[model samples]
Target: MKAELEQLKIEAFQLLNRAQDSSAVDALEIDLLGRRGKLSTLLARIPELPVEERSGIGTLASSIRKELQDAIVAKRGQFSAPTSQSLDFDPTWPGHSPSIGHLHPVTAFLERSADFFASLGYTIADGPEVETATNNFDRLNIPANHPARDLWDTYYLNPARAGLLLRTHTSPVQVRYMDSHKPPVYIISPGRVYRHEATDASHDTNFTQLEGLAIDRDLHLTDLLGTLEAFLKHTFGKVKVQVRPSFFPFVEPGVELHMSCLLCGGKGCSACKQTGWLEMLGAGMVHPTVLKNMHVDPAKFSGFAFGIGVERMTMLLHGIPDVRLLLSGDQRFLEQFHY
Candidate 1:
């Protein structure tokens, strides 16, 4: 029994040294130390051995198990050590360049328009695109059964709530500003507006509008026309302008301002539909009823208001044919305006 134990110890040591990896070492451990293994078998046979020899044999088996465990841990570290060469970066190589972004055409136009107004002593004002019916319609002198309400063609956020709608124009900002501030107000509201309508080459259901409002002791229709003329001349560089009578519910004695078609230089052309003129903006004296609604005394504080389509101005300025292209997000269409 002593000779058999010595032979098993030598064989186990040889197997442990031959193990090339942690997995092989684990298999060897199971073979020698498992419940049905050689070590376990020897331990199980202790009762068959003389009682004096059992203690010494058990001690030897435990010593062998400890040695095998230590060898496995040491071999695992050596097997996992990285053998590949380290990389060194070359400082002389050119680095990658990150892309730089520019403003979109619509955004560029808005900035330019804001700058133009700011130069005229008109501070920029803003309002919520999601607005109530009173601000969007009623406060602007648009009554429930009025035809002007149909013209707004608004996008309602919630119909059952009676008046929550996406604003049809930035004119609502004028009402809000009046409600909050006293007269001698000079503000240009520039923002996105929504409508429910079929899109065409010239029209978009969603577009931008810049509405200007100026209320003081003695504002008039002439002051409104003069301001628009100055803006158009500054914007288009010495362009010709003409105003024709028009109608709007919020403004009394409204007129549609027209500039000679930039594309054809006032000569008949396809851009102006052969009329030699392009309607640009709508301007008029602030209606008494509109002021009365906002608690402003129209008799003491008369004013003028105008609304211009930002997309139209951009198209006229850049000679863009389709309004849809402005909002389409097409890379090819946008790349042309890169500056």
Candidate 2:
């Protein structure tokens, strides 16, 4: 019986060493130490043996059971240890490419355009999207019954409020800035503007506009023209600019600034409507009415103001066929600008 017990100890040790994983080790433990297992059976049969022999065999069995339990625990530790590295993720394996994002084309253009102005000592100014008719139109010399007001085609928030309307342009920012700051003010107001216009290939109900105002002593139209020409060159990179007679109620003499078709290099093209020029922005000296409304003496301080459509600028720069694409939020259209 003693020899059999010794052999069982050797067999248990061999089986424990052969267990490939924790599950196999658990199975072996149940086979050797469970209620119907050899160690349990031996412990149960002890009462039938002589007292002296029973004590010796029971002690040996208890020691062997303890040894087997320790071995199983140690083997489980070994099994678990290797799993972390065994199911090893190859360090060199290609990982999933993370989705990257970028600024919208309009936004990129806005930043670049803003930086260009900033470099020339122009600071940024902003105003509310919801504005009073007085600021949006009246102060700019568009009277209540003036036909020029029709050109804006405004979106009024409350007709009863009479003058409260969504701003049609960022020119209101110019008025607001001048109202707060004295002359020698150079500012570019870049923001979203709302209109009630029907959407088309060239128009959008919601768009962005950048309005620039420079007020100081002795500023003239030539200064305006030269500044605009430098800005256009910086923006479009070596392009011809043309200023034609135009009128806006806010200015005594306003002009439409145009840049040569960048796509066709000034040659006629569909993009330029075969004219070889694209109307870029509008500029004029600050109207007396506008200056008077802001309490700035128009005679003492002459200044120029210009408004440029950011969407149009972005569209021309990126060769986008439709202006609507700027606000479409379509991934396919936008992904092309990803850095």
Candidate 3:
């Protein structure tokens, strides 16, 4: 038994010295020192020997086990020792550059439209998103119970004190502007509006509107045409414009303005429904009743007003197929509009 113990001690030391890596060291430790190991098996036989022999063999076995454990630990540490003389890192490698951002397409378009009108001597006007029912409807000549009111179906706010609701259109700003300022009033109102309508590819319950009003003595439809023509040219880059007769409660002889189909170039296409023109906005001479309601004498002062859907124009100009994308916060869709 003593001879076997001596043989094991020599074998274990040789294996531990030859161990080249951490895994090899681990195997050596398990085989030499673990439970059920060769040394343990040999030691277990000691209890069966003569009672006088047990103490000597047991002491030798314990001494051999401790020596092998120390050697195994030393082997593991050797593998983990640092290979370098000092700590260091390469300084020449390039670093990451952060991304740059620009305005959203809708906001960019709004600013350009405002700047264009400002250049034409039209001061920008603004009004509250929550407004009295009178300025939103009646003052614009759309009185309650009037059939024309049916056309502007909107979300009426709850707790209807002061008949307040989210402004259905920016036209209310023009009414507010006219009430305070006298003619020759030249102003454009650009703002967000709310409607109680269902959303589809082209419509949203919440969207933006830009309305323009120009009031002065002897203003005619021709002046409206010329100003809009220059604006269309400036905006869409030399597109043809057409005005067809339509009706609105606020504008007598109201006209729906159309721009040449950018996709088909006025030759007829699905986008324009074979008409070669896309309806852009509604405009006309201000109704005399609206003028008189605002305290502008219709006999002396005449004007023109137009309301444009800013999102509709942005979608058209940018070839954005869905109106919801303007409001969608998806980074991939919005990244395409970044400058």
Candidate 4:
């Protein structure tokens, strides 16, 4: 019955659009919204609906009916006699443009990055956001007592059973991928990650991360640096990249990848903390333990892996001041990116 109602609504709108005169619109209004109309017939069946679905179906039916009525009114008004010849305005006219739909900023950014990697023969990998402690931590060379765990405090959906929790990074996808695949692998894992942390303009409890992995014979730190540089240049268009020594359990000789500040043109600003470079990617050669955990012999296969905040890159690319705005459902904020 709900599906029938939805179909009826669509039919009503189609007929309404074909309405060429006030009389035609008036006929449609009565046929679709009158006491004996199609919508009225559906509403009459509300009591016949199942107990749990009654309220929801009725509400949806009501909303559809209301929209149909409004559309009818607006349609009829278009054919009605113009009250005045001055043409200054008409109170009943709808001046607002219909909303256009497009991809969310974060989704757009992820797709853009994925395309870049895909062009280079890297397959996209995926994993569940809810991950096991072993896959999320131990597989990445991070253990229960590892200090790095503190940096990514996360929510556990079921603390008492299996230590299941929301993954704090997309890197877990790499672990899952390696477990099932062998050497000569190239993939990018882009997905939402949860963190039990404070929300700010720059940070959120949940955000997107892009994990990059390339495991081919004779791959080196230079290969990782070059790939990152190309990605940064392709994404930001000629931006400078900096690599500094860093630490991540999953990677040996871990390094942080930084790009010149877009906000200040690398001159330095509060966004860059007076530093010309803003840290973008945490990357290095994959550690041997991580390979062993996934049943891949490190001696046989070596790879470089990196993770970067997708939303952070979106913010930088578009000069968006707040990370929250990327996910916020504000039409005004979103429509600005129609480009």
Which runs in model 3 stand beyond 4 Å of their true positions?
1-93, 159-162, 263-276
The residue ranges of model 4 lying beyond 4 angstroms of the native Cα positions read 1-98
Models 1 onward score TM values of 0.70, 0.73, 0.70, 0.71
lDDT of 2: 0.86
RMSD values for the candidates in order, in angstroms, are: 10.0, 6.4, 9.9, 17.4
* Best of the candidates, TM-score: 2
Clash count list over all predictions:
0, 0, 0, 0
Determine which window of 10 residues in candidate 3 has minimal summed lDDT: 82-91
lDDT of 4 by residue, 16-61 (tens): 9998898888888888888998888878888887899988897898
Candidate 1 lDDT tens digits, 21-50 = 878877877888777888788778888988
Give residue 184's lDDT in candidate 3 (0 to 100): 93
Considering summed lDDT, which 10 consecutive residues are worst modelled in model 1?
Answer: 81-90
lDDT (tens digit, per residue) of candidate 2 on 140-221: 8898999988889968886788879999999999888877799999999999999888887668898999999998999999
Pairs of colliding residues, candidate 3: none
The local distance difference test score of model 4 is 0.86
For candidate 3, write residues 15-69 as lDDT tens digits.
8888989999988887877898899889889878999988999999989988988
> Per the 3 Å backbone cut-off, how many clashing residue pairs does candidate 3 have?
0
lDDT of 1: 0.84
